[model samples]
Target: MTEPLIERCGLRYLHVVGRNFLVWRKLMYASMLGNMADPMIYLVGLGFGLGGFMPAIEGMRYINFLAGGMLCYSAMNSATFEALYSAFSRLKIQRTWEGIMHAPMTAADVVLGEWIWAALKATLSGAAMLIAMYLLGLVHGLRPLAVMPVVLLIGLAFSGLGLIMTALAKSYEFFIFYFTLVITPMMFLSGVFYPRSALPPVVQAIGAVLPLTHGADLARGLTLGTPMAHPLLDVLVLAGYATCGVSVSVLLIRRRLLK
Candidate 1:
């Protein structure tokens, strides 16, 4: 009985691990090299290059201020790439989940495992960026180090959201709608390049609703030695986003598959 229960619990998640490893295996050194390059370019080009004209922000050098925001941005990008692009393709084209479900695995188990896997990858990417930030001396002392785990939580929050979007997506084209209307606006308005306080009251209120805004706020506060507007509130909001998104994805995938 113990062995059976253990297998039942472990089989689905193990498959998810194996599948993700397989996917990672197909990514060549060139692809990894490109991902490594994109962030550095953003850091140098926008941070160092454009930062000169951008003015000093919040008592820190503009480039340094932007690095925290860029870290948040990078984490979001890594999560969405796996959850939206790859997850949707696997579900629609590869039918990978279908094959897994035919065995002892349930949809819930597979999705939970897959989302965790995506979050793991996102966290790894974020950690890599954090190391780069440390090397630059942008992160001082143990506070930023303490915040590293929270930064990963932020990544998981976005990964969960991206998974839900993948479930809702009717086609890959639908992703553009989200990217354009929601993400693009948030990317610009979120205190990435500038403080949200500079926005009009109404726009500030709107920015408050976006996940990236809170993530960036928390990150910038920690990294730049700025006081948090409301640290607990930001954590709660991020947690809420993760919970709702994961719940929705689980429900949708269950309806589509196990039902």
Candidate 2:
């Protein structure tokens, strides 16, 4: 009989995190720059280019509004990329997970550790975006610092989701479907580029169910100092996703590896 997921996991996962951290440290500057650069380009190019023409969004500058979207988007992209490509490399290309499992760990521990490592990386990207926005005067006040926690949650939520996709993926080619069908649509429809209301009602219904929508809503409200109708609901939805991702991915990965 297989071991329970809970029983198979322990503090040893931290060692996995530490291992990834040490590897990351060697190229920290390059990795950090990669995380920050792409989003900064979006913030600067679009904020200055397109935002210059548009009027304030709900009394906030267009760039300020864009900054909020970029914040969550940065976390989402960073976590997804790390969970998918980097994690896949470790799992498939490098066979890192197999080697790790030889130690006193299980598949669940590997999944948990990889998910966490990806989340932490994504959080760093979000922090970079937050600080950049602060320097650019896009976010203000002590309250905006609270966005970091939300950013971390966004990281966990998306990275977990990414792992689910990773578990199902047969090859790196499989990822194109996820990015094209899921990530790209969520990026546009989650109010990252504009208000959710701007989308059609049918589309709004679709976006409402996605994790990114809740995440962007939280990011926008907190960063732009605006009120949200259901902040608690948004947080719950993301937490639910993170939970589901961990649960489902563990089961699937166990099947993939052990069965």
Candidate 3:
């Protein structure tokens, strides 16, 4: 009974993913263009423009230092955008989730499927950025390839976080508050553009708790071939956020849909 039930759930979610992929295929060009453009601009603009005047950071060129962070940021941005805007549109505007619920699937399955879809999209975006970095010679050696799993982990963490916001959102406008208050701060404070050590002690402490910080640390360590201060702790932190966020998202969306 239990095994069959699990298989059924997996198949249902895979169906959802397949449906989304088909829809995305129609707009693949635009989606890929936008995803590639944004990160490339950031990499060139901040990395070269700003990094030109900056001294070597952590014993590496500024662009080299920024590359790994960009990889993590790409994953984070992709996951969050898919979870917030795309998920909200499906759940509220397009009524896609409503249509899916009419099938044999539960609200839990819908949310899980959406989360998985978002994570996959994030991974693709991150992979694109990683390839660009590699072509530019910012990443070297086989160790950089190890960052792929970390990118997926970052995706999972942010996707779940995005869905939580989606559940609380009453309208599209609600996301402005989340983006401004939460995501923006995390981008700046989470060691993406600079080292966490440069921040004040209190802010550093706060950054330490953010999922992106751990993700950045992991990505940087792998890409630069530097040893992590505490790699095990970083993995644990990201995994904790992903697990909690998904659980909370399921519970929240269940209440919202059932009510």
Candidate 4:
């Protein structure tokens, strides 16, 4: 393909997002009942419930901390779920990826389109959750607005990784290992409910390796109105993750589909 056409292929990824709009809209409505409920329970349970005992983080309310972490969680959940479940389904059962490749699009285009869509969906879902948190007064200043781009970067990074995982995944059951071993651990150890400094030295080192740790730190700093430190490092690491993820995902799709 020509350079312009290849670039356009990336743009078609937006159509991939548009195509799924209705289905996600319906799903989001259904998810809202559950998504909204879980955050509310957490905000209440920890913010006011356990918050009575635990002091605020950095002098900010506990709920605010909880809200920021949860917002990041929501975006991560959305991106990872879509990339893993839906992408796997299309690649395996539905053969949607294969079908797309038969069109003017190549395997690279198919993977790129799907990953981009997943990122967009994840961003929308996460943003909705953030707005809900804001309405509840759990969110802090407009600094939290910085979260939008961060959410996009995190989602894009995870979407590529999710694609790579889906490509390698043999069954839905395989996801169990990923969520249990990797995702769950990162969720807790990434300084969600507490500070990373609270952990032991070795564990803190492990936390630093996880992208969620940096993502959470960035989100928390913005939401709580704290000064950003080494902001470029955070961006660079997340960008590195995205680059590796996209490279692997493209390679996998080409190997799987074009072969």
Candidate 2 off by > 4 Å:
none
| Predicted candidate 3 versus true structure: per-residue lDDT over 60-167, tens digit per residue | 999888888888898999999999999999999999999998887888888888898999999999889988988898877776888899999999999999999999
Model 1 compared with the native: what TM-score? 0.89
| Residue range 108-195, candidate 2, lDDT tens digits | 8888898899999989999999999989987778888888888888899888889999999989999999999999999999999888
Candidates in order have lDDT scores of 0.78, 0.90, 0.90, 0.77
Off by over 4 Å in 1: 1-11, 26-28
Where does candidate 1 clash, by residue pair?
none
**Considering every candidate listed, which one attains the maximal TM-score?**
2
Off by over 4 Å in 3: 1-9
Give the 10-residue window scoring lowest on summed lDDT in candidate 2.
1-10
Better of 1 and 2 by TM-score: 2
Q: Determine the C-alpha RMSD for candidate 2 after optimal superposition of all C-alphas.
A: 1.1
